[model samples]
Target: MASSTPQSVERALAMFDAVADAPGPVGAKELARRVGCSLSTAYHLLGALTARGHLTRTAQGYVPGPRVPALHRGYQRHLGVGAGVGELLVRLRRATGAQAYYTVYRGGLITVVDSTAPVSDTAEPFVPGPEIRAHATAHGKALLAGLPRPVRRRYLDEHGMARFTDRTITAADRFEAELARVRGQGFAVSVGEADPAYTCLAVALPGPRGDGSVHALSVSLATAEFRGRRGAIRGAVARAAAELVPEG
Candidate 1:
């Protein structure tokens, strides 16, 4: 068996990243140029990724498919926050006896960084990781509401509004109202299928210039448990969020 060249692996990784982060569909020639690989090598890398479902060819050009997002899910697992969040969610679940989650905002979309549940029940409660609807999850809303006005506006414009559940705040006016509420309360909450039979509470992780980092801590539980423990859970979540924020 022959060992793959380090340079080839590096180039392939670069090409994958370039395509995943591209604002829209990317052409093979431009992708090759951006990744600093020869056209032939770039083509080969693209084909390999496409074969693995990472990229899909469209009428315009090559666009990332679900596999790119899946890869991103795994990639985030290696970020600095991933290790920290794992411990945090575990502590949070112990403190609250419910599922705990942490998510990061990427390009206005929310991505789960880590999560934990007090009990390992068989219910497929939104598995940790993968991009999630920013408006529907308390974790996403908390982080998004904390972002700078300009960035938040741009995100809204780009993603527009997509309804996930009847309870999802889709209208711009109503969503803004909800955001205002999050700002005033310093946390966010989701009831029922905005995420399922769960209730979620989240708070933003502060960022430089108070610009708001796309990161948050959330605690979730069956609606019954949450309703019974709402007050205590809210306090615990707020404290967790404070702990996660960097001190000035």
Candidate 2:
């Protein structure tokens, strides 16, 4: 049986979808009516999701969170850039035998927009939310490298390179150099430092605008499996990006 907390969360999720699927913003009263819940219950749920950036209020009513559209774009990026990016990730995950992730730049931070973990002993899923190391993760580095040089310097200066593991690169200059190389190679790699015995392979995806801003995707897995299949993993991610990215 599902716990009460999960049940409440599920109902809240339904309420958000009901409001979001509407043609335009929906009023709390109408939303509650549509959700078949009391007005108070509806407001409470909306307030919670809104607080967490999963929903937002508008003059018209309430709408999906900003993250929602970006997530949609990441999944469907192969078809067109408007939305549906999650579907692409699903396909990539199935093809790659590793965990796949999508991220977008938000408030100068790289937020994990979505992810899919392979069903295997080698796969270890990182709980999705805000990434602990936006500066260290392969997706984070890909996004960072796409930034202007000056902005990159400022970020490094402000967040002063912190180490996650023995192998994590913490020197600002070295990391800057690594970013330059990533830009040249068109992909990023993180080995065994972000998490012990795991490696991440990532690539920055071009957006609709010609600017450096990007949508990034990465595949992560245990070190041994990652090393054994690195070439294939890299090729799969590259192909997915080529298919999904508007510029590609």
* lDDT score at residue 124, model 1, on the 0-100 scale: 40
In candidate 2, stretches whose alpha carbon ends up further than 4 angstroms from where it belongs are 1-82, 118-125, 208-212, 246-248
The residue pairs in collision within model 1 are 105-214, 193-196
Per-model TM against the reference? 0.64, 0.64
lDDT string for model 2 (153-211, tens) is: 77667666678889888887889899999999999988876787788999988664443
C-alpha RMSD in Å of predicted model 2 compared with the true structure? 10.5
Tens-digit per-residue lDDT, 26-106, candidate 1: 898898888687889888988887898978878788887677666655666444364466777788888998788877776
Clashes found in each candidate (C-alpha, N, C closer than 3 A): 2, 11
* Candidate 1 TM-score over all chains jointly: 0.64
